[model samples]
Target: MGTKFGSVIHRADRGTFRAKYTYHGEVITKTFKDRLSAEAWLNGERSRVEADKAGITKWTSPTDRKRQEAAVKRRRTLFCDYVMDEFAPTWLNYATDGSELASGSKRKHREYLQHLTHSFFWKYPLTSITTEDINRWLADLDNFGGATPRKKTFQLLKAVYSKAVAEGAVAKSPVTMKAPAVPKSRQAQIPPATAEELQTIYANMPSTTRISVWLGAILDLRIGEVVSLQVQDWNPKTQTLRVCHSADVNGQLKSTKTATSNTTQPVPPQLGKLIDKACEDKRPTDFIVTCADGTHITPNRLRDHFNEAKTKARRPDLHFHTLRATSITAAVATGASLKDTMQWGRHADAATSIERYQRASGTERMREIANGIEDTLMGHEPTREELEAEIQKTKERLADLERQLDALK
Candidate 1:
């Protein structure tokens, strides 16, 4: 009872044991509730002494041990290495559907990520980088490619660091600043072409490519979405086009971009006639728009056709996507609500509809807004007396509002 297996067991304390040993030339003693713990402590102390004799200094203080671990981590992991070895494989390829990222998206990520790995920050410790370093990197991008490139590069780095934080690889992201500002003058401004200009382009396009232009301008269909449509996706009786699939960046056909993108859009009679002309004598599996040899039209060939049409129309600034912008702007100008525009354009948010899609409306459209207000006020003829009384009440309300504002001041 006095001693048991490298521990002292007291007779009075039957369940507990005392452990004593020499560590770093000092006698270290501790009491343990069990022989196993006491024996473990004794063994650890003996190992530490052996390690010290072997020229390996074992850390005795908690602070010293933490410092040494941090140094070792910094030595092993660099920002570039972490992104290439860990983040890219584990996080970048991850998706909700358990599939890899779209080919086009991966290409863009790789392009922008180079801005980080090729810069001075690549050798920085993964966990040691601070907000100031991120800011400096963003600021230096101006000499490289100006504001837009700078913003893209910053976003890529921020995404990587955010993944690091989420996985507990780093405590927080060093990228805390807002996006770089792109001046309106420096931005690549593509104004929406008018319906007349679009019609001119349509008239000059070949029969096969005309269908593509019509779909883009009228239905706001993306180039990939238009080319991916099969003859069966069209309902001739209802004049509705079901957008179920699209071509990916690599020119391979896939499902639509988002769930909201898979929609049944109404087709105008003119556009429906165009589709019928293109799909004549074609089977249900056949693409509605095809090349001269009856093969599926790729995006590269579609761009060449669009370029020819743009030149013939004498609107060199117009690209294929300009037709989509024109359609969205035209939709807004025709008194469509923001919600209706979002649904029609397959947009996930109204901000994109208002800020990006809905371009500057002309003076005539401004007058249309005034006309709408006039119609609302003049819906029914009001008696002269009633109208005068309504005007007096409005004046009184304005006066009351001014009085309340003055009181607050």
Candidate 2:
């Protein structure tokens, strides 16, 4: 009486022995801990086996043997080798970088696939994996990186296995064996600094380095473009900086991120003056901006300077991207159109600019509403005194509500 759905073991060596058997053209092995266990186990399964395989017979197991058989039948397969051999091929290529994916994308895929290989996906045969296997995998994904990541990784795996099917490896992708859903919620980015904070950073910067910093943040010129400025790229007449090329500290010419990335950026008036002054002492043969050592600025040195600026401004969250973001925000706030903002941000999409830099504070929104009401009611906007008084009253109301909530807790 072997375990349910396993071979019936008649007898074996005194120690545990496994019996190999064929069922429906597939081989399976049934293990027995001892001869007595095998005999007692098989004896009970005889009638059931005969009923299943034979014309007629009735079988019943010894109570403990029946329990043991049930336990063995219920044991699950769990292994890593199965995934590498059966699932990893057609995709999961480490040769290609996944950096182009948005933030946390790589981390999500790595964690989910890692757990699948180590936990269960590799343990079972490709045919044995079921809807249940995929459901559990997605749940773990949700716990790790939220529902969006789980959904994304699920789609990624599905694509990987679809490729596998095309490669004549797996007959079909098992990704749709389970499907999970995430709620619809928009997650917009919260940029790290305001224009005031950015200007504060620029104010304390070294004069020699300040224009270079401003060129990147205010003009959104990439490091290469900022350092590569030739004296002739500046057009005082059009107030534009033609972005045909940019350079490294060594003035090495390299490709911009893309073909569209090779466009011009118009210099705002203030930024234009800084650039004008910076280009004043230029060698006709030299770049518009140079480092303190008088060589073209390197990306690393530009970042180092940006970091110094952040330190001076006491804003640790500032990055080169933040400077570029500040430039976009300033332009947008001053009523630049989306197309112009895109040109200034050098963003692949206008939505990216909106996502990364736009800040609509709740307090400012309420203030605007109050001021508008005052203007309509009195045919004039509120005085500073009226606005201040309103703000103080709102603060007290908020404090009282917070105190009440805290007391309840």
Quick one: best lDDT, which candidate? 1
**Per-residue alpha-carbon lDDT of model 2 for 45-89, expressed as tens digits?**
545556856656433334446666744443332224434555554
- Give the least accurate 10-residue stretch of model 1, judged by summed lDDT: 1-10
Each prediction's whole-model lDDT (CA):
0.75, 0.62
Best by TM-score: 1
Q: Positional deviation of 349 in candidate 2, in angstroms?
A: 5.0
Kindly report which residue stretches of model 1 are placed more than 4 angstroms away from their true locations once superposed: 1-42, 45-76, 95-99, 142-146, 183-188, 248-262, 348-351, 357-409
**Which residue pairs in candidate 2 collide?**
1-41, 1-42, 1-43, 47-58, 47-59, 78-123, 79-122, 79-123, 228-247, 249-296
lDDT of 1 at 339: 73
Relative to the unseen true structure, what is the Cα RMSD of model 2?
16.8
